[model samples]
Target: MVDPSPESVELARFSLWRSKLDCAFGWFEDAERTIESLLSPQAQNQPETLPFMIFIEPHLPRMEGLELLHLLRSHPSTQALPVVMFATSYDETDAARSRAAGASDYIVKPVDAREFMQVVSDTVARWLPVGSKKAD
Candidate 1:
């Protein structure tokens, strides 16, 4: 996950924990760290065969999620990876742009824990491998 808000990350982490999913996570508030994480498998503790399903907010620093998604698509290491756009508001233009840029999905940031959990459940169901600790 990548967002410019530590509080948001913390809340998401807490929500995941409360839902009883046993997953490891790494988060970033900046583009550089996110890029580094994508480039280095060891940094993320991920096997080389599995690509990351990135959850990134649309409104981020020097490189917004849309631009970053394009970059990732172009880069050999991250090409074919799944990128999910997350934003506070739903803009058709942004959604279209994300689709054009090869985003796997676009999600509007939820205002409450329940909504966020629902999003997580949907995301895991669609993108994660089977047998993942599903949300109740």
Candidate 2:
């Protein structure tokens, strides 16, 4: 997860935990740090350590999510990873741009807490490997 909002990150973390998904999660408040972490020599040396999926918000303080998505798509290590771009509200142009930039999905964040959590859980579940078991 690469959301700048602490609330958003906490919500996502709680949602994943409550869903009982056995997965590791990392959060980045800015795109530059995320880029550095992902494109570092250590990361390049061990591509397998890269994340299976990434959830990013469209608007960020430094580099925008779309720009970050483009960079990720161009990189060999993260090109194939599923990228989900989310926003507080739906915008046709943003959705189209995200798809063109190789985002796996685009979602409008729900204002309702429960609905938001459900969306997060469903999205994560959809991307999980087949036959994946819930955390005990």
Q: Which candidate ranks first by TM-score, i.e. highest?
A: 2
Best by lDDT: 2
Name every residue pair that clashes in candidate 2: none
lDDT of 2 at 2: 90
The residue-by-residue lDDT of candidate 2 on 18-84, one tens digit each, is 9998788899998998999998888899887788899989998878999999999999999989999
What's the lDDT for residue 121 in model 1?
55
lDDT value, residue 17 of candidate 2: 91
Candidate 1's clash total is 0
Taken over the whole model, the C-alpha lDDT of each candidate is: 0.76, 0.90
Span of 10 residues, lowest total lDDT, candidate 2: 127-136
Each model's total of backbone clashes: 0, 0
TM-score, per-candidate, Cα-based: 0.81, 0.95
Candidate 2 vs. truth: CA RMSD? 1.1
Return the lDDT, model 2, position 99. Answer: 98
